[model samples]
Target chain A: MIWLVWRQHRKQALFALAALAALAALVVPTGLTMRGAFADLGLPDCVRTLGKAGPANNETCLTAFQQFNDEYQGFLLVGILFLVLPLLVGLFWGAPLVAREVEHGTHRLVWTQGVSRRQWALAKFGLVGAATLVIAVGYGLGIGWWLGPLNSAGQRNRFDPLFFDMQGAVPVGYTLFAVALGILVGTVWPRVLPAMAGTLVGFLGLRVVLATLARPRYLPAETLTFPIQGTAVAPRETASDWVLASGVRNASGELVVRGGSIECPPNATGPGAAGCGTGLGVEPGAYNWQLYQPADRFWLFQGIETGIFVALAVLLVYLAVRRIRRIA
Target chain B: METALETDQLGKRYGNTWALRDCSLHLPAGRIAALVGPNGAGKSTLLHMAVGLLRPDAGTVRVFGETPYDNTAALAEIGFVAQDTPLYRDFTAGELVTMGGKLNRRWDGTLARTRLAQLGIPPDKPVGKLSGGQRAQVALALALAKRPRLLLLDEPVASLDPLARREFLQALMGSVAESGTTVLLSSHLLADLERVCDYLIVLHGARVRLVGPVEDLVAEHRQLVGPRHGDDPIPGVASVVRASHTDRQSTLLVRTDGPIGDTSWAAHEVTLEDVILGYLADGDRPTSNEAWGVPA
Candidate 1:
């Protein structure tokens, strides 16, 4: 089944491999050493800027060694890449698995062939599902090896939440989640381009809203909003912001914060809180909000969240299978 | 009569409009039946019911004396060819044949191979690249390779050219003759239908208008040309499918069990197309001729 699915999607596989290979070759230097200029251009300067660059470093060997040991934040890019395309495949490629047949009335031929609708749908889902798993793992392994040096160097650098949460097993988990989301969207909207746009728009919207609503400026625990002195946005969006970090919990526990700094509202009562009701308060710690460290709780929360999304995916798939089977 | 497929007053409604109403058909084994109608005549709906694709709001469809759904053993007795003949564009002909072979228990790989070869679909050619006519042939091959007891086809040749459609029907009839398989195919081309179909079902306005053996139907109905007497009906005429009159003469398409004894109207033998168009015209009228249980 997977072989069939892969055969159909060999074009995408080839494209992904080509992209990865080209990037790898562009970065390669003689003997694949840290002495290469590509190494300096990619991370050495960035590490020095972070005040963590080591001298005359065998960074390639370090990078190669750290590929497994150190968590590569760049693996998140792999997640983003896998996240976007498979979703497209699901919408454009997978959506037509049944709906197109029914739309064109070809499903009737397949339907009457003594193969139950359940079996038919199962074959498609099983095949595509396996393909997704393989793609996620392959991508995860490749990026983990390629960007090892940056991750090891960044361990000494200031807290960069993007790279911080991207290491180890988390990127793989997130990519799978995104792919599942894409599949679910495909099931819901079976027309090719519409499903693709819908998945992108819907997921992007949800991510944006979640990021905003869970931020300290929008809503804080006990306090309506944070009372930070000034907005502390980074020069680049890639710069680590403590407030919007993923795996971070919300004050109300209803949601999770992704990353960004939030500006606060006034205090509720007492001391400086007396001026809070009548005035636009400027005092720091007037409604003090604390940021939590990434801990066991964070991973537990991540696991729980990914599990819920996966469950939703499974339910959508079940409904889709039933729908396709009901087609005569 | 012992029937291979039977529908007991099957009815289906989509929202406010009824797509099929009280449609009853009994097709016996080893007969080539054709379901004929104009567009939106409930032909597709009725076929869907027979194949267990759609559930009737009222009544039932039984295949080989049982429902065709979920019952794998029951379905194994049937193969279907649907209209539009759509295939996965990315898959090659070889892959599709392989798929059919793997999925079906009674699959005849030799038949698929032979048919595919005869159809001239090379092994590596993508289904997407095949022309409309070639795709239809591949679809037919897929259906026949199952070695079904009963074959249900919905408008299998609606899009094919004259030669290709003729070839499809001929090949199908040839296979049926060899295997004694009961085939039910739907098509709009009367000439092709006349050549192959022994049994006929005419559907109009979501209802079965007329059904019987082709020979009997052709024998009973006649294209009569004569002067109209609005006050006096034709002698022994069961039903007038359509009536159009000029000042000097009237033409009445009449269907009767026996001959209508009207010397004034020259009883000309009706072609299959005339028979089909007649029923369609009858079903189109603000009908009061509800001798059968046709819904109001």
Candidate 2:
């Protein structure tokens, strides 16, 4: 059974390896160059002072930082690629795993062999599932290593949703989940094109929902309050804290609107319109706003998100097996 | 003889229509059985159920007296060739045989290689490049290499030319001679099966219309010619399968167990094709002009 699975999927597995190799070939040199620049140009010390530490008063360090960011524009595209890689895996590798067999009536051939359906399903999932995980982990390692300097230098937020999914452990979990989803959809739909389309749409939908709606509440976000001073809202507490929502409270203790903007009645006029009742106010501690999930909780959030996706992947595998058994 | 395959009121429905209904039949061990039916007559459905590829909506289907659903031991006893004889288009014939050996506990690798060799199929040639006949041979070799006690084939030669069909059947007969495996072959055309099968199961309208030995079925059903009877039942005629009556003469294909002792009518032998056609045509409203001897 293992040999059969290998014969069937060796081409795909080798293709996935080739893709990972290509990605590594591109990322390794760029990563080494970034590391060299970080050292040769004293960008580490420059980041220490000119980044979130204090004001950008040193012109030389600021120029170095700007040059570093400019040189790594391709890093952001790589990040986006990492984000879309799992969907591609689900679409091509996982969706077609079973859908192609069914569409071409080869499932009848395989299932009619001496092996039972359970055994066949196990062999397929075990091989393809493991390959998907390895590819995802390889991708995460390369992309994360390339972005390590930028992340630590405060050029990018460690807790930002855009960067979080492309970093440590979570990408592997996401890949497993996508593969399981693809297998489930392929088994249910039993058509290659439709299953591939369904997997792409389904994976993207789940990812969007998880990143936008679910990740923020993985842990109770901590709130920070500061007194309103002058017309300007002070900067956030830290550059790495994710600010989920910030709003000013009214006299009735209800959040009126976003913290920075203030609305006035149409009939209101003169200086008062430009002051407390209409514009930026200076009432100390009267209405403070909040930020969410700080940088320190990054690992905790990764663990929780990975846990959720891994659990869902296992459930989907079980569902796929049951569906395979139910096929007639 | 032990029963190789049996269905107890097996039935299946697709949406609002029944594809097979109460189709109970049994084939004894060591006999070559023919499952004859027209298109949509549920022959494939019945064979699929027997091999556990399909689930019956109504009743039980057993192979070698054991239920085949999810039972690995029961499944190993039967081999099946689907209608199109699907194979991996990318794998060479050698790889497919290797796959068969790895997947089946009792796979006969030497037999697979020798059989493909005999068929003039190169071991390294991919199935996609092979002709339809060669692909069918590969499929049959894979099944026979399992050495199953019962083999079920669904229109294995439907797409082959006459010579290829004859060669395919000859290969099948060779294997049957060596192994004595009970075979249930399904085909819409009885002429394709007349030379190979000894037992017959005729299906029509999702129901079993006839089940018996080919010789007994032929000998039991007789074609009668006599004066026109005008839609009335005649004495000594068991049941009219097909009838065509002219202005002065009537020709009727009837099934009966008793001897035709009537002196007024003459009896003629019924070919297997004629018997199959009569049963299938009887599915529609039988015409008095549809009998074999009468002109339309």
Candidate 3:
């Protein structure tokens, strides 16, 4: 049975591996260069003591850090690839798994063999599911390694939706979920192209809704009050705070909307234009209250998100098996 | 003794239409049964149900006296080559045989190899590149490699040319001769089933119209000719399967157990094709033998 599954899907499995290999080729070299640059500029120690640097050293370290960061805009492409990798898995690997068999009338061939339909489905899911997880894990490790310096420098947040999904264990969950979604749609549609289309649309819709609406509420946001120090609290001190929302509030918990200054030209692109509306007015004793998930909760949030998607993947696979049984 | 295949009031419906309904059969073991019916007569539906590829909406179907639906042990005793003989287009013939060997506990790899070798097919060639007849042969080889107790084929040669169809059937008969496997094959082409089958199950209008040994069924039905008779009943006839009247004479295809000894009628033995056509013609109008005014 294992041999059967491998024989049927070796092409797809190899294709996935080749994709990962290509990504490795790109990230490995770029990652080494970036590390070399970081070390050569002596930015490691500076980044390690970023917050406590003396004014004179701070200026020089900041310039070195900017140069290191500017050397690799290629990471943006890698980010986009990780974001779309799950959909590619769903379309090429998952959707075609069952849909092509049905479309080509080959399901009848395997179904009528000594193996039962349930066994056939189990073998397929077992092999392909494992392959998808391996690819996702490899990708996760590669991207995490590539982004390690930026993250340690406090330039990238672990909680932002894009970075969070691309690193840690969340990519594994997303890959599994996308594959499950593909299988479910393929079984229901029983046609290759339509199932692929449906999976792409369904997967994108699910990721968007989950990331924007459902993810932040996985754990309650912590509330904090601090004195409104000169203009807008300087955006949070920690890059990974994952601020859900923050604004001026009176002691009674009411919002105080500050009006923009009439003296600034609207939508200016000049250097100081961004801060033009701030310092317009200040309410006495009013503090800037924040609702946020702090950086320390990164693992907890990762666990929660992965748990939800893995659970959904399991359900989709179960449903796909049931549908396979009923296919006859 | 367990029969090769049996169905008890088997019924299947597609939406508002009934593809097969109230169908029942008891095919004895070791008989090469041929299911003959015109297009849309539920022949494929019956075969599909028997192999467990289709679930009956009502009643039950058993292969080797056990329900095959999700029953691996029962399913293991049966092998099916569905219509068009669908195989993986990209898999080489040898790879498909390898798959068969891996998937089936009872698979005969040597038998598969020998069969393909005898067919003069290159084992390394992809199935998609094979001719329609070669593809059919490969499909049959895969199914036969399982060494099933009962082999079910649905129009395996439906798409082949005359020579290919003959070759395909020749290989099938060769296997049957070698292994004594009970085979139940369905085809609408009466010419195809005439020489190969001993038992016959004729289906029409989603019902079994005639089922018995070919020799017995042929012996029981007679073509009767006599003077014009009104829509009147005829004695010594079990049922008038078909009837037509000319200005001066009447021709009737009738089923009966007794000998037709009346001087008013000329009796002639019926051919299997004639018997099948008679039943199929009666298929459009639903009526039974008892409803034909035969005295109880």
Candidate 4:
């Protein structure tokens, strides 16, 4: 059974290897160049002085930071490739694993052998599942290494959805979930093209829902209040935190509106209007309030998200096994 | 005789319609039994059940007295070639043979390789590139290499050309002669099985209409000719399978255990095809036309 699985999926395995090599080729040189620029620009001192009043916040250091961002931010576009890698695994490796067999009627050939259908399904899922894990982990680590300088410099937030999805153990969970979903759909539908399409739609749909809706509520967000001055919010204070919501509150603590802008009453005189023109703190005792998941919770969120997807993957695989046993 | 495959009150349904219902039959070991039926007559359903590809909704299907559904031991004893003889298109015949060896506990790698070589099938060519006849042969070789006790084939020659069909059957017969394996092969075409099968199971309308040794079934049925105006029932005839009439004369296909005693009627021998067509023609018309000599 092992030999049969390898023989069948050797092409997919080779393609995945080639893709990994290509990813390494793209990241390695860019990473080295980015790291070199970080040291040469002395941006480490600027990052160290973040949120403090110091010489590192001076014009030269600020210009240096801007220059560093200008030179390397374009490389982040490559992250999109990593984003779709799990979907590719789901379509090519997982969907076709069973759908192709059934579509071509080869399931009749393989399932009639000495081995039971359970053994056949397990061997295929096990081998492909392991391969997907290795590829996803390798991809996550590569992206993590490539984005190290930008993340440390506060130019990019690790807690952001894009970076968070590609930086830790979560990619493994996502890939496994995608593959399991593909297998489950393929087992039930038994058509390669439709299974691939269903997998694509399902994987992307779940990812969107999880990232936008469920992620922010994984743990209760911490709140912070500060005087709403005329200036914009400081970047350093919210550097790596995932801000869920922000708004201005009235003196009685009712949220007048979301965001920092404020509107004065139409009959207000010059001084009152002038005060309102300076943004939300114009009203007495009102301040800017922010709801956010702080930077320290990065790993904890990663654990929670990964745990969710991994549990889903296990459930999908279990359903797939049960479904396959009843397939006619 | 030892039974190789047995189904008692087996049934299957797809959606609201039954694909096969009340299907019960026994295939004795070492007999090449032909399951003859028309399209949609549940031949494929019965074969799939026997091979464990389908689970019966009612009753049981057993191969060598054990349920074949998800049973590794029972599966090991049965080699099934489904309709179209499906195989991996990208794998070469040699690779397929090797795969068979790896997947089965009792594969004969040498036999598969030698047979393919003798058949002039290129070992390195992918099966998708092979001719349909060659693909069928390769599929057969893979199934044969398992050395299974019961070999079930569903319409193995339904899609092959005349030459390919003959060659495929020839190869099948050759292998069966050597192994003495019990074979149950189904086909809608009667001629495909008439020359090779000693036992016959006639299925129609998702039910078994007739089953017996070919020789006995043929011997028990006869064609009778008599006057159109006659008694309602004919003597010495166990059952009238089918009947047609002209204004002056009547012709009937009848099953009987004894000789026809009526001197006015002529009793002629019936071939296996005649008997099968007779049974297949049963229950196929409205009841209003079922009377004797009703011109249907």
Candidate 5:
């Protein structure tokens, strides 16, 4: 099924990848130049800089950094590819999932071929999932060179809320989430515009509402449980406070950080697909932070987010399968 | 006992409305059965259920005496040509054939190519570019190449023009005749069904209103020509569907098995169209020997 899905959308996948390649080519020179400028400075020799507190220098430096961040982030392009391109592609890609058959009333032909409804659904999902995965992996690899320089810069200036901060791996993750959502919407709702609009509205709406309502409570730091240094990673052991630092895509398509340092709370009914501390959330608690690293929190966040999105994706596929069964 | 296709009280419901009801049917091997129905008549749903695309809300469906769903071995014996002659709009005919060939174990690629060539449908041509008739032919080739024991179609001719529809149906009939595959096809046009189908099943309101050999049904059904005045008794003829007259002459569409006893009315052969209208128009059920058709 994934093979068919891959074949059907192979062109679009290649095109998105080609665009990513072009972006990489355009940005690699600038990244190299930034590396050269640092080497020329020869002061503290490539230390992460806290820029001087002067408006003119700050503006120019920040602008330069932002351009590099834009390339490394690639959210604007990747997100559009995942969210918007799919809706149009769903017209071509997802439409045949069942819509055109319904429109032409031709599903009857295939339905009678003795292949069960479940097998049919499985095949289509396999195909579309493969295509979406290929596009995502391409984005991840293509942007690696541009982002590596920044990581090597060992930059620790937290003031510049640039592209890489919010729209990094987070957007790539979110885009896959959107693609899965589009597949379900396209299959069930069927008509092109309505399916696209409903998907856009519903996805944005739910993610925003969840972010707004759940953001503060989800981080572990607010719970104030003492930072128990990785005690064998076992649950049911009364685990300590953990922080949830989120880089969320907002309604206007801008990436923003929602929470500061927060505490983790213990939830009994944790994320169904186990791992990466999905069960840990935050509220006002008894522990305080000593020195917390954002990278630790980043791991926990990505793990939880991946589990959540994957669960949601699996659920969407299940619903689509059921809907298709009932279609005939 | 091992029928090619059988349904035991098979029914499909869309929420509160029943698409098919009490549709118990059995098709033995090597019979070409035409499922005739009006639009919205559960024919497609029935076919879907037969092929295991849709589960029956109640009762059971089997192909080759085995449940089609989840029975890959059983499914291997069936080839379906869906309504509207559907194919992956993205694939060229050749690619699709290759895909189908790779997927099915019993594929006969040589035969498929020959059929495509004979039908004058270029395998390199994208199905999207082909005419409706040509696409239908391509679909037929693909299905035939599977070498299935049972072949199913749902309104495969609905999109084609009148002449193309006839040509496609002829080709389908020829295949069935040549191979002796058990065939079940659904359509709205009874004239074509009558032409090619040896067995007939009339579907309406999710029920099997009538089913039997076409010849038997036609032979037994007769239109009675009688005068208007007499309220005469008729033997062998079971029911009168409609009666009308001008002055002294009267015409009656009645169903009968043998010689009519009504002295006042003369019996005449009924057209297949009239017999079909009787079913579509929602009249009496035609018994095996009963014939109630009006001559036009």
Candidate 6:
């Protein structure tokens, strides 16, 4: 059974290897260059001292950080490749696993062999699932290593959706989910092209819904209140925190308006703007509030999201196995 | 005789229509049975059930007295070449043979290779690149290598040209002779199975219409020509399978238990093809003798 699985999917496995090598070709050199620039600019020391330094030294650190961001920001496009890798695995490797067999009527041939259909399905899923896991973990670690300098320089937050999805254990979860979804869709649909299309739509749709509607709500966001001024107070070390919402709140805790800025009279200027707040029926206790998930929750969030996706993958695989058994 | 495959009151349905219904028959050991029917006569359905590819909705299908559905032991003993003889197009013939060897517990790699060599089939060429006849032969070789006790073929020669059909059957017969395997070969064309099969099962309207030894089926059915009489029963003619009438002449294909003794009728011997056609034509009528509890 193992030999048969390899014989059937060896081409797809080779294709995945080539794709991984191609991705490596793009990331390896760029990662080295970014790391070199990080060391050259002494950005590591600068980031460590950013909030604690005197005004003059702080200015220098900000300038160095700005330069690093300007130089390496374009490389963020490589993250898109990592983002799409799992989807490609779903379509090319997973969608056609069972679909092509049924479409070509080869399932009838293989199922009637000495091995039962259930065994055939399990062997394919086991081998393919293990391969996806290895590839996804390897890719995730590679992305983590490549993005280390940028993330350390405080140019991008690890909590950001793009970076979060591409790094840590979540990519492995995504890959497993995508592959399992592809298999389940193919088993139910029994046509390669349509199953691939369905997998694409389902995977992307669930991702969008989860990222937008469910991620921020994974845990109750912490809120901070500060005096209303020219702008909301910038926390000393919030570079890695995910700010979900920030707005002005009145004394009664009702949101007066939903923005970091407060409008003032045209005649009011400089210090006079402080008095403008009272003219608008704003109480003296009115303050700005920021809702955020702290940087300390990064690993917690990764575990949560990974748990969600992995659970979904397991469910999809179970359903696919059940469906394959009942198929005529 | 030991039974190789048997189905009791087996039935299957798709949507609102039954693809096969009340299908019950037995293929004894070492007999090549022809499952003959028209295109929609449920021949494929029955073969699929026997191989456990399809689960019967009503009754049971057993191979060597063991239920075949999801039973690895039963599956190991049944070889099936589905319609069109589907194979992995990307693999070469040799690779397919290797795959078969890897997948089956009892494999005869030497027989597969030797047969392909004798047929002059290039083992290294991808099966998709082979001619339709070569593909069918490769499929047959793969199935034969399993050394299965029962081989079920569904419309194996339906798409082959006459010469290719003959060659494919010849290869199958050669292997069968060597293995003494019980074979159930299905086809809409009677001529394909007439020469090779000693037993026959005729399916029509998703039901088994006739089943027996080929010679016995041919012997019991005869065409009787006599004076036209409106719905009149004839002595020694047990049941009318098919009938046609002109102004003063009535010709009826009838099944009987004994030789026709009435001198008013001239009984002519019928071929296997004639018997099959008679049963198939009988399918279109509102009523049949089999429906009336007459033994088929």
TM-score of chain A of each: 0.53, 0.85, 0.86, 0.90, 0.57, 0.90
Report the lDDT of model 1 for residue B168: 78
TM-score: model 6 vs. ground truth: 0.93
lDDT (10s digit) by residue, model 2, range A87-156: 8888888898888998888888888887899888998899889888878888877777887777755556
> lDDT by residue for model 1 over B75-138, one digit each (tens)?
7888777777867666788888887776678889789889889878887888889987888878
**What TM-score does candidate 3 reach?**
0.89
Q: Which residues of candidate 6, in runs, are more than 4 Å off?
A: A51-57, A152-155, A229-233, A236-238, A261-283, B282-296
Clashing pairs in 4: none
Candidate closest to the true structure, highest lDDT? 6
lDDT scores in order:
0.64, 0.83, 0.82, 0.86, 0.64, 0.87
Query: Model 4 - which docking category?
Result: high
Model 1: which docking level applies? acceptable
lDDT of 5 by residue, A166-238 (tens): 3235444545566567667766876656666666776677666654554334454332223222222212101
On the 0 to 100 scale, the lDDT of residue A280 in model 5 is 40
The CAPRI class of candidate 5 is acceptable
DockQ for candidate 1, C-alpha atoms = 0.47
**Pick by lDDT: 3 or 5, better one:** 3
List candidate 3 segments past 4 Å from native: A50-57, A152-156, A230-238, A250-252, A258-282, B227-229, B245-250, B261-264, B282-296
TM-score of each: 0.74, 0.91, 0.89, 0.93, 0.75, 0.93
Model 3 deviation from native, Cα RMSD in Å:
6.1
Task: Give me the runs in candidate 2 sitting further than 4 Å from their true place.
Answer: A46-53, A56-63, A153-155, A230-238, A247-288, B230-235, B282-296
Cα lDDT over the full model 3: 0.82
List per-candidate RMSD values in Å: 9.1, 5.1, 6.1, 4.4, 12.1, 5.0
**What fraction of the reference interface contacts is present in each model, in order?**
0.60, 0.72, 0.70, 0.94, 0.43, 0.89
The CA lDDT at A298 in model 2 is 83
Please report the TM-score between candidate 2 and the true structure: 0.91
lDDT of prediction 1? 0.64
In angstroms, the error of model 1 at B202 is 0.6
